[model samples]
Target: MPHLVLLYTPDLETDADIPSLCRALADTMLEQRDQAGKAVFPTGGTRVLAYPAAHCAVADGKGPYGFLYANLRMGSGRSEQVHKAVGDSLLQVLKRHLDALLQQRPIGITVQIDESQAQVYDAKHSSLHPLFNRPA
Candidate 1:
């Protein structure tokens, strides 16, 4: 499972085109492959969600400064190289997506991937996975 949660300043919502970013990110996740060339994240388990903060205060509470924080959480098993590759790919997309808004205003973007350890109790119940399991 790989879920990307984006938290951004409310002011950027109008110009952020967040829905597009979510689609791009989901596609990027589906594109990731392991050393064996198998999909790293299940198509049905991939999710990208964005939430605009109701109230945000930029540095010194000065001019309008926007911020986008992306956190990707996935089940652990991949190698360090795979993790880095995934993170890099995501960061590049995030930067490219917000480049235009960055030039127009002061915005900070941060992207990070978190691997859920074995100790973490996780549970899932969904019919979506079967849809992706059908023969091509």
Candidate 2:
């Protein structure tokens, strides 16, 4: 249920490659499972996407600015520490992915991990969950 959506300014398109970033994020979640001993997300259920806004304004309306905003939405069952772990791990990936952009210019990256309310949230999954659980 961990779905990450990335929104960036137009100029950062070069640094924010959607397909590659998505795979990286999915791998990061899998790494959490390997390290923390928990299924952070289903392999087939991980959804990481990127969207470049048509119009964006940051700081001031002076020069071209780049911004990377990642929002992670998941089911509500984890502790604050777990949330921090996810956020930190995700931030590391985003930082590394956008390192060159940041080094060459002034860019901002933010990662926000949020939980969905169990009462209102609804989901539909498939047999892919079992596929992911199969022995490697």
Candidate 3:
């Protein structure tokens, strides 16, 4: 179970880039696995999921802005450093990608990590997810 969940608003240009970002995240997980000696994934590899139903509040009464939600899961073995590293890597990549998409438009990016060992909850209901789902 990848403990990290990286969320972001969809790029104004294209939302298809999310899959590529997910791939990069998976690569990072593998690198981290090699360095940390703990499987980032309990199974063969990490499970990366994407959501196209993101809504961010917009300026007028118009509504939420378009966004893409990328959920990448890698078993972290409950390591705090791993959690931090995951956030760091995801943010770095997301920042670069979002910057290109924003094109100087006002935007915000955020990453959330779940380190709890009890159980994995739905990302929709997850506290971390909503925090990043703020108005634009």
lDDT of 1 at 10: 92
Give the local distance difference test score of model 3.
Answer: 0.55
Tens-place lDDT per residue, model 2, 19-108, is 777788878876774345777676777888889999888998686678889999987777777788888999998888878777787888
Over 101-131, each residue of candidate 3 has an lDDT whose tens digit, in order, gives: 5564555555666544555564433444445
lDDT of all predictions? 0.91, 0.80, 0.55
lDDT of 1 by residue, 78-101 (tens): 999899999999999999999988
> Is 2 or 3 the stronger prediction by TM-score?
2
Please give the lDDT score for candidate 2: 0.80
How many clashes would you count in candidate 2?
A: 0
TM-score of each: 0.95, 0.86, 0.60
What lDDT score goes with residue 38 in model 1? Answer: 91
